[model samples]
Target: MEKLLQGLIQFKETDFQEHRQLFEELGNSQSPHTLFIGCSDSRLVPNLITGTLPGELFVIRNIANIVPPYRNIEEYLATTSAIEYAVNILGIQHIVVCGHSNCGGCKSLYASEKEMQSIPHTRKWLELAGNVKEKITAMNIPESEMAKREWMTEQINIVEQLKHLLSYPFIKERVLNQTLTIEGWYYIIETGEVFRYNRHNSEFELVN
Candidate 1:
């Protein structure tokens, strides 16, 4: 907590002063171009990874970076509200769902219900990733290769979230009209490599 306070002071003294104009413009209104949906992993800093400034990307972070399929948002509004605002109000042109290499949420997909009993809310939230497990299981991957299974789950989860995003009527309409674009991104936290899903090839390729 003290470290965070010190960082805040440093930002006010150095970084904030250096970018005073940028902050001033942002103070009035923000017009970010991309909506970045990524894991709430401390290691995955979207701005640093994308080389973006404060007003460049509007970001939403969640426990596995899961995008629950569009539904009537009466109860769960955390991620959904952000998505709606980023699209409807902010007019973001690109939506990128990024999943990382070693994610605790993705790791929990393999945990038994009893094992996840303690973290009920987390378990419930991760239920949105059920299809990721189902699809990977259908692939019949070797049971001995646990690491490979986890990696595959992480990548498949990104694609699954992309499908979820398309389930939104507004998002789909915008995508169809070429007003918005969606991307499934995989980030290697260990190697700092990024891969983006190529719809044409139906595979994730290095993001150059």
Candidate 2:
């Protein structure tokens, strides 16, 4: 708490002052160009990774960076509502779904019922990525090779969420018309490296 308080003071004194003009301009309204869907993990800072300014990326962070298939229902719908605003209202041109290495939410996909009992809501939320586990399991990756399993799970989850995004009619129409672009990213936390998914190759290539 003390450290966070000191960091807040430091930010206000240094970073905020440096970007005061930009902040003032953004005070009234924001027109971000990209919608960045990323993991809620504290280690994955979207701005830091993308080198984007405050108003460049409108972000949505959640467990595993899951994008539920669009549904027409009158409910809270936090993630769905945010996506709608960013695309339909804010007119974002690009959408990036980023998943990171050693994702706890991805790991939870393989958690036993006993282990998941404590986090009932999280377990339910993760059902969106349930098929990711099935895909990994079908690959026959040995249990001893947990690292390989984790890597595959994380990357595959990103691809799955990208598919979910297209399930929205507005998003699909824009994407088909070439008005909007969507990319999947795999971020390596320890190495500070990001890999962008190439739809042509259907693989994640290092973003050089």
Candidate 3:
């Protein structure tokens, strides 16, 4: 807490002042080009990873970086509203759903109900990745290789959420008209490397 406070002070005294003009310009309004949906992992800082400046990317973070299938406004209001506003109001051209290696949320999918009883909301939220679990489980990977399975599931979750994003009618329309593009990203926390899904190759390739 103290560190964060000191960082805030430093930002105010140094970084903020260094970019005073840019901050002033962004004070009134922001026109970001992309909407980044990433996991709520401390190591996977979207701005730091993408090297984006303030107001460059509108970000939304959630457990496992899941994007639920579109529902009525009253449902999942926080995430849904951010999506609506980013695409419709902000006119964001690109949407990126980024998943990281060894994500606890994705790993928790394999946890028994007894282990998750303390986190009811989390257990419920993880239900959004049910499809990923089903698809992975069908592969019949051995329990001995749980580590490999976990990593695969993390990447698969990114693709799954990308599909969920299309469930939004507005998002679908924009995509069909080439007005908006959606991409899946995988980040390796250990190596600080990023990979992007290549639909053409049906595999994730290192992002240069």
| Candidate No. with top TM-score | 2
lDDT score, candidate 2, position 45: 97
Evaluate residue 90 in candidate 2 and report its C-alpha lDDT on the 0 to 100 scale: 97
RMSD of each: 1.1, 0.8, 1.0
The alpha-carbon lDDT assigned to residue 74 of candidate 3 equals 52
TM-score of each: 0.97, 0.98, 0.97
Best by lDDT: 2
Against the true structure, candidate 2 reaches a TM-score of 0.98
lDDT of 1 at 106: 95
The per-model lDDT (C-alpha) reads 0.94, 0.96, 0.94
Which pairs clash inside model 1?
none
**CA lDDT of 100 in candidate 1?**
95
Better of 1 and 2 by lDDT: 2
Q: Candidate 3's residue-wise lDDT over 21-86, tens digit each? A: 999999999999999999998888999999999999999999999998898755447788899999
Candidate 3 residue pairs in clash (backbone atoms < 3 Å): none
